[model samples]
Target: MKRLLKQSILVLAMAGMAGCTTLGPDYQPPEVDVPQQWQSSLTEASTVADREWWKLFQDPVLDELIQQALENNRDLRIAAARILEYAARVDIARAGLYPNLGYGADVARTQSSRNTLGAPPDGVGRVGSNYHAALSVGWELDFWGRIQRSTEAARANLLAEEYGRRALVLSLVSSVATAYIELLSLDRQLEIARDTLKRRAENVDLFRVQFEGGVVSELEVAQARAEYETTAILIPAIEQQISITEYNLSLLLGRNPGPVARHASIAQLVLPQVPGDIPSQVLLQRPDILQAEQDLVAANALIGVARAAYFPSISLTGLLGLASAQLSTLLEGASGIWNAGAALAGPIFSGGELDARLRVSEAVQQQLLQKYLVTIQRAFSEVDKALISSQKLREVLAASQRQVKALKDYNKYARERYDEGYVSYIEVLDAERRLFDAELEYTRRQGNSYVALVAIYRAMGGSWVDAAEAVADKVDFPPQDAPESRHWWEYPPATRPAAQNQP
Candidate 1:
């Protein structure tokens, strides 16, 4: 019997080794249609997409705010936490590849009535005490690759979570930068409004004086007062917006509503130039796209897992221990007892459950495949839109600057004409009004340009925070033979490098 058991074990081991083939289709990244060049005419230059892109703005306060949001943003923290959760799940799935061992002990007392137990001792009850201790082990051999496929799926999920975290970080950086730029723009507008109000107030006094001297009508004074009040009204509304924006930023920092620190005004901030030649293939490096691909990989692995369920599951269970009525004898050889067994379970009749599950898994894989493709396409669209927006907004900003300049000149000349009685006060008022509106619009255009640039960086999957740099304070020397450093997204197809291999 023992020899037969040994032979059986050897056969099973050989069978397990021979059946190691995985059951599902191996994962291949879906092919995508990549544009040869962007539609915009921006020159292709070394991409600033990966390196602390926000630093291009050259604002220390803005830099600090982005850093703060990265460290403290609630959504980013949640994403980071999810990475830990999926990592733990990976371990759990991997554990299935190995045996599980457990140790157990028991002490118990039992009594049986004489009538029920061999009529013991002339109708007297029988009592017994027992003690037991054992070590148990069980393992499901991956003869059909179920455990292996599950582990593969789990590992892919972990990677997806990690990529999700990266996507969140990218988004957080862009959001903080955009918010900061808007705040500065609003501040500039508020300044413009207040300054315009002061000038309008001076105009009201001038109109009143001219009326008393019979040089102007009371109607002129009334018009001047109305314009001053209009400018004054804008000040409070702008202030309200600033307060709300600050509150929103505070939430991003995981803090209660409060004031955010500011260093540079809108005029002092310069929009970063968009990097010239960007490759469209760089969209693949986007974290969200990578995350979606991982999801597809995981779904693909699940199909294998479901397919494996159609094969026999082989498991071995054994207990090695001693059992005795006396606790002291529990470890003695005379009390030793051992049992071992193997099980083979296969789907003989499951009312089509196994077949349905396989179909479900396949359907899920197909869905994820489509979603992954969509994600890639969307990423490309975003980059294209941002590229065009950046170019067009630059033109808009230039025109706005020229308009502001011309309006300023017009306002000055109109004021001089009014003083010389060469034109009506209404001309001066209209010129000033146009200049004020142009100044506000110009500031807005500047803000929009910065926002569009942020979008481009985000769409390209740029990184401001390096994983290594976060843990260390010092910079490493660059390799002497290394090619000019390029952002991850900037490498052309012939020169594109693969990411580091993961276990």
Candidate 2:
């Protein structure tokens, strides 16, 4: 009997080792044709993609704000948690490759009535007790590579989630910087409004006095008051916009709606040097593209899993234990008992269910493949758009600066002519109005130029992400080596009451 058991175990091991080849298509990364260089014209600016691009702005407050948002942002937190969730799923899928070992004990007492015709003879007591203890092992042999495929799919999903989280980090940093720039530009606009209001108020007092003394007409006083009112109304409008922007920025920092601290005016913020000579192929390395590719990998692996469902599932189960009527004799050799068995279960008929499932998996793979391609295309498109915006907005900023300067000179000349009685105050008001609009536009152009730079960095992903991550929040995975600390899922279903309540 012992030799037979050994032979049986040997035969089963050989069968498992000789399982058929893995099913379904193996994943090979799809090659995408890329332009040798970006379509946008290249510049001689120093490359900033290899370093922390935000620090190029040289604003300490901006740096601190980005760090805070990275650490506290709810979107980033959700993405990080998704990585942990997928990692657990990978472990669960991998466990199918190993046997499950468990121990069980049972104690029972029974009484048979003597009045029953089928009762045991009087040699045995009417009431008796039996005790049994056993160790059991069950393992599903991977004859069709189902478990391997499932594990492969799960691991790919884990990687996809990790990349997704990284993509979120990249987006988070960009958003914070953009919002900060906008807030600073609004601040500059408000400053300009207040200064203009003060100047207009002084003019109103002067024109009213001149009109009372018969040196100027009442029309001049009315025009001065009208200009003063215009500038006065603008202050509150800019102030309201500032408040709204502050509220949006505060949300990014994961804080309550409130004012955001600034370290410099919009004009004072340094313009980051554009990264030059970028190859279009670099878009493949963007976190979103990588994440999409991993999703494709996972989908491809699922085809194998679904295909394997058509084959028979083979498993080995064994038990070795002690059983006896007497507690003290349970440890004796005579009480020893053991059994080994093999099971083969396959779908005899599923009413087209298995076929439909396989079709579904195949369709999903096709969908993901298209999605991956779209992601790559979109990545390249974004880079192109960002580069163009950066270049064109720089030109806009230059022109706006020149316009502001010309308007400033025009305002001065118009005021002099009015004082010399060569022109009406209406010319002065028109020049001042044009100058005020130009000033606001110039400030807005400054902010947009900086924002375009941020967009460029975001679109052309590179090592700067690692540099940013060095200062951002850190997510720690659960320690796998700590045997004493068990996850709720590790507990048996009957023993884990808390698992039912877990999310």
TM-score of each: 0.89, 0.92
Q: Tell me the RMSD of model 2 versus the true structure.
A: 6.1
CA displacement after TM-score superposition, residue 270 of candidate 1 (Å): 2.5
Candidate 1, lDDT over the whole model: 0.78
lDDT (tens digit, per residue) of candidate 1 on 1-503: 34544554564455446646679888988888887877767753456776788877889998888777766677765655565566567778879877777899999999877656465685454788899988777778887678888988887887787677667667777788888999999999999998889888988988888899998898899999999998998999999999999999888877889999999997888777786566677668777888899999999999999999889988887776779988888777788777778899888899999999999999999999999989988888888888889888988999999999999999999989988989988898899889998999999998898898888887777444344124111111122443466333222112235673453
* Deviation in Å, model 1, residue 136 alpha carbon: 1.1
Model 2 error, position 176 (Å): 0.8
lDDT of 1 at 365: 94
- Ten consecutive residues with minimal summed lDDT in candidate 1? 471-480
Clashes of 2: 0
